[model samples]
Target chain A: MTGPWAEALPWVIALPLVGAALTPAVAVRRPRAAGFWAWGVLLVTAVLAAGLVSELLARGPFSYELGGWPAAYGIELRFDHFSAWVLPLALLFVVIVPFSWRYLDHVMPDERRPPFYALLLLNAGGMIGFCVTGDLFNLFVFTEVVSLSSYALVAVGGRGLAAFAALKYLFIGAVSSLLMLFATAQLFVLTGSLNMAEVSLRLAEVGGGTAVMVAFAAYAVSFMVKAAMFPVHVWLPDAHAIAPSPVSAVLSGMVVKVGIVGMLRVYQIYYGAEVLELGAFNLALVWLGAVSIVMGAFFAIFQDDIKLMLAYSTISNIGYIVLGLGLASPYAVIGASVHVFNHALIKATLFLAAGSIIHQTGFRTLSDLRGVARAMPQTSAAMAIGAVSIVGLPPTAGFVCKWYIALGAFEANQAPFGFALVFGALFIFIYYIRMLNAFYFQKPVHAAVAQASETPWSMRGPVVLLASLCLILGVLGGIPLTFVEPAVLDLLPLWGP
Target chain B: MLLFGLDLDYVAVVMLFCVGLYMLVAKSNLLKKLLGLNVMETAVFAFIVTAGMVEGGDPPIMVAGTSAPFASPIPHAMVLTGIVVAVSVTAVALALIVQIHAHFGTIEIDELKELP
Candidate 1:
C-alpha cells in the first residue's frame, strides 16, 4: 500500500484542488456543514502531506509524471526535503482555518459565510501545490489558484478598506502574473520543457543570454512583488491591515514565504553562482533589503493602529530573510531558510494573538489596549513571548534566525550588515516595549478585567500551539536545521573559504 | 502564391494585448476594467494557441473516426486552465469592485481615495 501510493505525489496537491472544485455545491446544500467539510479535507491533505514527507525520506526526492508521460513532455510533481517540509507548516495553517470558522461566525453574520471556508481550503491546497511541484508552468497555475481565491478572501470580510486593498492586490497580482507568464513563455521557448531540473541544465547552457536574463529579471521582480519587497511593498501593509485576521495570518505567514521561495529557487537554479559571483544581483537585493529594514521599522513606529503597526513590522521582519538571501553565504542561506520556517511560526503566533485581542475588545489602537495583560493574561503572555522573540532573545526561534543571519552577513565580509541586524534588534525592543507597556505595565483606566478573560478555545488553542512551537523550535533547533541545511546547501555555491 | 507560407496571428494577438492593457489601465469604470482584463486574458490565450499550431494541424482532440495528426496539446492544456483561472479572477475582482462602489459610492479609483 505504501509503496504504490507513495508514487502519487499529486494526491497531496490534488486533494485540496478537488475540495475547492466541490466547495460551492457543498455550501449551497448545507452551509453549516461547510466548515466540517473544509476541516475534513484539510486534515486529509495534512495527513497526505505527512505521508508524502515519510515517502520522500524513505525514497528520497519523489517525482511523479503526470498522465503517464516522461519528464520532458509531462508535468511532474517533485518533493524534496526542502519542498516537503513546507507541507506540515502549510497544513498547520490550514488547520487554523476551521478553528477560525467558529470565531468568524461569532463576528461575521450568516449572510456572509457560504463560500468562505471552501475558498480558504482551496487557497491552502493551491499554496501547498505551488511549493511542492517541480514544473515551472504548473507553478504559475497553482499561483493563480491561490491568488484568485485570495482576492475574494480579502474582500469578503466586509471592511471597506478590505475591498479596496483587494483591488490594489488585483492590479499588482495581474501585472505580476503577466510578468511571470512572460518569463515562463521565454523558458518554454528556450527549453521546450516545463520541468525544473531539465530547465536548469538547459538554462546553464543558455547561461546569461539576453532572453534568459530578461526571463530571470521578470521572474525575480514579479516574485519580489509577491514577497512584498520594499518599494513594491507598498501593497502589503494595507492588505495585511484590512484583511480578516485568519486571512492575514495566512498572508503574513505562508503566502509571502511561497513567493520568497520562488525567488530563491530561480536565483539559485536559473542565475547560478557565476552570474552572482560577479555581484550584480546580490548587491541590488542587499541594498533593497537594508532599505526595507530601516524603512519598515520607521513606518511601523508611526502607525497608531495596532494591526497596521504589526503589518509594518511584518514588512521589517521579511527584510531579514531578503538580507540573508542577498548575503549568499552557506550560513546566510541557512539563516534565510530557517528564518522562513521561524518567521512562519512566530508571526503566525503574533497575528493570531493580535486577532484574539481585536476579537475580544473591538479595539485596534495600541493606546487603547492598556492592561490587556491583566485582562487577558493568556493572550498577553503569548504576545510577550512572540514579541521578545522578535527582538531576538536567545532560546526563542527568532534568536536562531537572527544569530545565523547576522553571522551570515559577517561571513560575506560585511560587518555593517551585522550591525544592521543589531540595530534591527534594538528597534524591535523599542516597539514591543511600547506594546507591552500598553498591555501589562499600564493602569487599567477602564477596569476592563471581567470582560477580558481568555478568548474562546478555538482562538486560544491555535495561538498557543504556534507560540509553543516558537519555544520548542528554538531549543530543539538542530532538528529542522538538519532538513534545511541539505536544502540550502543545494542552492548555494562553493565560496572561497 | 508560394513565395512564403506564413500566418499572421502574432499581429492580431499583439494588437489585442495592447488594446486590452490600455483599456484596463486607462478606464475609470470598474466594469470596463474587468472587461479589459478579460480581453487581455483572451489575447494571451490566442497567442498560446498560435504558438502550438503547426501549418496543417488539427484541434489535437482524439476521435474514433479520424486519428489525424494535430498540433501539440501542451500549450492548449495550459491555455484551457488559464482561461478558467482568468474567469475566476475576473469574477472575484468584479465582485470586489461592486462592493467598493457600494461603500465609496464611486467606481473611479481617483474618487475613492478621497474617502476618509
Candidate 2:
C-alpha cells in the first residue's frame, strides 16, 4: 500500500513545525504577515492530509518508516482509519487561522502576532504528530509539544490573570505528562520495544500482571487529566476562558481531545494484548462520566461570564464522549469517535461567535450583553445554532452522535446511564436556553451591547461557516461513521469489559 | 540491598516521587511547587535510566572499548529527550511565574487566591 501519498506522511508533521520555526523570520518585516503565512502552511498541510485520507480509503492502512528503518527498531508513522482525524484537525486550523488574523488586533499588539501564530502552528503540528506516531516515546514527546505550546498560548493574551491561569494549567498538565512518560518507560522496560504494535505483541507474551496493570492505571489517570474529566478538570475553565478568543476556540474545541485520543490508543494496546480485566475500570469510567456530565451542567447554570459558561459546557460535552466510550458497545464507540469531530465544529462555532460579541461590545457577562441579538444578528444566530447543536436537539450535528450514544446505552443494557444521558441533556438545554433568552428576549442593560455591530468579515465568515457545518453534519451524520465503524469493529472482538 | 522485597533503587525512586508530589500539593509557594515538579521529573528520569542498566555490561558506545551485553541505549536516548523536554517545561513555568508575580505582586498561591 505504499503509494505517493505514503511518501508525504512525514511532511504532514514537518511542514507546520518548520513553518512555526520560520514564522518569526517570515514576519520580521511585517508582523501581520504571520497570520497569512500560518494560514498558507496549514492550507498545504490540509491538502496533504486529504490526500493521505484518500490513500487510506483506497489502500487501507499504510506505514512510513523514518530513514527507511523497519518497524519495531526505528520510528514509523502509520496512517490507519483513526489517523484520518488529522484531516478534520488540519481543516479546523485552516478555518481558525483566518479568523485569528483580525481577531488578534483586539487581543494583542501587532508586534506580538508572530509568536502567537508560531505557538498556534506548533500546537497544530504537535497534535498531528500525536495522532500519527507509532512509537510510545514519540507519543510522549508529541504530548509535551502540544502541552507546552498550549501553556504558552493560554498566557499569550493578557496580563496577571491570564498568567495565573496558564501557570495553574502548566502545573497540573506537567504532572499528567510525567505520568505518561513514566508509563511509557514502564512499558519499555517490560517489552524492550517502543513500537506500539510490537509492544502489544510482547505484552501478550508477558501476559496479565501487576506491572502491566499499574502502567495502564497510570496511562488512564494521565489521559483523564488531559481530557479534564471531573475532579482533575480544575485547570480547564480558567485557562480556556482567559485565552484570547481564537485560542479559546482552539483549546476548547480541539486540544482537550488529546486525552480522549490518548485513551483510545491505550485501549488499542491493552485490548489487543487481551490482558487484565477492564470491567471494573469501565464501570468507574461510566460513573465518573455520568457525574462529569451532571456536574459540568450544574456549574454552567451559575456562570454569568459567557466564555466561562461555554468552558463549563465543554466539560459536559466531553462527558458525553467519555460516556459513549465507556459503554463499549459498537454503537457507543462509533458515536464517541464521531462526537470528537462534531463537538469540535460546534464548539468552534460557539466560541468564535462569543469572541465576536466580546470583541464588539467588550462585555462578557450575559446580563451585560442583553439584546445583543438585535445589533449583531448573524453572530448571535450562529451562537444559537451552536447552542441547539450542543443541547443535542434535532437537525443539528450534536443530535446524531448523542442519539447513537443513547441507543448504545440501551444496547449495552445500561438503562440507568441512558436515562442519565437524557437528564444531562436537559440540564445543558437549560443553560443554553438561558443564553438564547438573554440574547433575544431581554432588554439591553448597556448601550455598547445594544449598539454593537457585526464583526468584520474575516471573523464572521468562519463563525457562519462553522455554524452551517453544525447543521450540515447533522443531516449527513453518516459520513464520519464510515471512517469510525471499521476501526471500532476491528478492536471489538477483544474489547472485553 | 532490598527494601520490603523491592530493589533499594526502586524504593528510593518511589520516595522521591512522593516527596515531589507532597510539595506540589501541600506547598502554597509557586516556585517551590515548580521545584517540586522538577523533583518529580528527576525521579522519573532516574527510573528510566535505572531500567536501562546492565549489571556488568560496557557502555553503549560502538568504539573498540564497547562489546556484547552493552546497556540498552534506547532508554538513555529517551531520558536525554526527556531532559530536554523537562528543561523546556521548566522554562515555560518560570516565565509564567514571572508574569504572575509581575501582575499580582506575589508568588504565593494563597495570596493570589485572596485577591479580588
Candidate 3:
C-alpha cells in the first residue's frame, strides 16, 4: 500500500530539481521574478521535508525504493534520523533565499541574479539528495553535484579574488571527490554491491586486510577534507569570505556539515560490524579533533575579516563533533549529532548577520566596522545571539551539545579530550568578546560605518528567526537528542547497560 | 601479467596517481595544475575499470548462444559517468583560467599573488 510519506519522499528531491531548471528560463523573460520564484519552490520543499520528519517521528525510520525496484538493484532513499537532516537543510534554504533577494542586487550586477538563484537552489537540492540517499555511488554523485554548484557559487562573488578562490576550491574539492570515488570502488570490488546495507553485510565477512585499511583511510581523509577539519581546511576561509552573503551562510551553515553526515554514514557502514578494529582510528580522531579544536580557534582569533573568523571557527566546531563521534559512547554520539545541528544554526545566523553588516556598511574587517551596533542593532544583536551560542555559553544552543560531549568524554575515560573542549571554549570566548568590543564599546572607526544604515527587513527577518532558534533549541535540547539517541544506538551499541 | 613483482595495472595506477598529485602540488601554472587533476581523475577511473576485468573474459554483451566469463559492466558504467563529470569540471576550470587571465593578466599562481 502507498502511504502519504512515500508519495512525498520523492517530491522532496524532485521539486527543487524542477525549480532549479525553471529558474533560468523564468529569468530569461522576467529577471526580477527569479528570486521570488525560487523562494516559493523552497517553501514547498520545506513543507515536504517537515512532513517527512513528522512521518518519521510517528512511524520510526523507513526506506523507500525508487521506481518499484528492489533495494539491492535499484536506488534506496532512507529516512532515518540521519536523513531527517532534510528538514533543517530545506528550511535553511528557505531562510537564505529571501535574504538573497536584496543582497544579490546589492553585491553583483543585474544580469547574474537569475543564474545565481538557480545555482543556490541546485546546491540545496544536491545537499538534500546527498543526505537522503542510501546507495554508496549515489552519495558520490550528489557530493559532486554539490561541489560543482558550490564552485560556481563561490566564483559568483564578482571577479578579482573570487575566481581564484573558486578555482583553488575546485582543485582541492575535485581531488577529495576523486579519493572518495576511489574508496567507493575499493568497497565495491570487495563486496560486489554498491548499496550501503548490502556492503555492510558483506564487509563483515572479509574484513581486516591491508586493502580494506587503505580504503578506510581514503574515506576518512576524503570526508575530513569535506568537513574542513583543521589541516585540510585551507580552502574554506577565502572561499567563504569571497562568496556573496547568502551563499556564505549556506556554505558555512549547511554544506560543510554534509561532510560530517557522510562520516556518520561511513561509521554506520564500517563500525556497525565487528570485523573492523577502530581503536587506532578512533584514537586518531580524538587527537586530531583535539588539535583542530585548539588550532582552529587559535587561527580564528587572528582573522580580521568577519566571515574569515567565522570560517575558521567552523573548523574548531567540527573538531568537537569529530571528537564526540570518536568517543563512540552513546552520549558522545548524541552530542556529536546535536552539535552538528546546533552549529549549523549558530554559524548560519552569524554568517548571514555578517553579510548584512557588510551589505549595509561596506566594511569587511573588524577595525573598519567598529560600533556597527548603533546603526544595525537588530543584525548585530542577532550576531551576538549566534556568538553566545557558538561560544557554548549557558542558556544558548551551543552549551547543550558541548555539555553532552563533555560528559561523554569523561564517561569514556578520555579526560584529556574533555579538557581540550573546555580550553577550546575559553579560547573561543575570548575572540567573541573581542568581536563584541569592536561592535559596541569601540566607536565607529571607518567613514563607511559612520554612514551605514540598518539591514533591510527581508535580510533582518531570517537572522532574527535563527538567533531565536539558537535559544529555543538550546533550552529544549531533548527535541533533537531524541532523534540523535536512537540513530547513535543503531550504529554503535557499545554503550551496554 | 606482472612487472617488478607487482601487478602491472595496479602499478601503473599508483604511478599515475602519484605523478598527478605531484604536479598538482608542485606546479605553479594554473593550466598545468588542471592537467594534473585530469591525470589523477583518469588514474582513479583506470583503477575502477580494471577492477571489472576477468582473465580471458569476453565483454558483457550476450551473443546468440555462448557460455563465457564476462567482464563486469557496472564499473564501466561508473567510469563513463565519471568521465563526463571530469569533462564538465575541466571545461569550467578552463573558463575560469580565461577569466583569471583577463582580470589579473597572468595564469601563473605566483604572479597572481603579485597582482594588486
Model number with the top TM-score? 2
Whole-model lDDT, model 3: 0.88
Span of ten consecutive residues with least summed lDDT in model 1 chain A: A269-278
Stretches of candidate 2 off by over 4 Å are none
> Mind giving the per-residue lDDT tens digits that candidate 2 earns over A386-484?
999999999999999999999999999998999999999999999999999999999999988888889999999999999999999999999999899
Candidate 3 Cα misplacement greater than 4 A, ranges? A494-497
Ranking 1 against 3 by DockQ, winner: 3
Tens-digit lDDT track of model 1 for B1-116: 12235346766776888898898889877778778877877877787776676667777777766456678777777788887778778777877887887888888877776777
Which ranges of candidate 1 are over 4 A from the true structure?
Answer: A1-5, A23-30, A271-278, A447-450, A494-497, B1-28, B35-50, B53-71
Top candidate on DockQ is 2
True contacts kept of each: 0.47, 0.93, 0.56
Cα deviation of A160, candidate 2, in Å: 0.2
Clashes of 1: 0
Best of the two (1, 2) by DockQ:
2
TM-scores of the candidates are: 0.91, 0.99, 0.97
Q: Candidate 3 DockQ category?
A: medium
lDDT of 2 at B47: 98
RMSD of 3: 1.6
All-Cα superposition RMSD per candidate: 3.5, 0.7, 1.6
- For each candidate, the alpha-carbon lDDT, in order, equals 0.78, 0.94, 0.88
Highest lDDT among the candidates is held by which one?
2
Error of 2 at A110 (Å): 0.5
> What is the CAPRI rating of model 2's predicted complex?
high
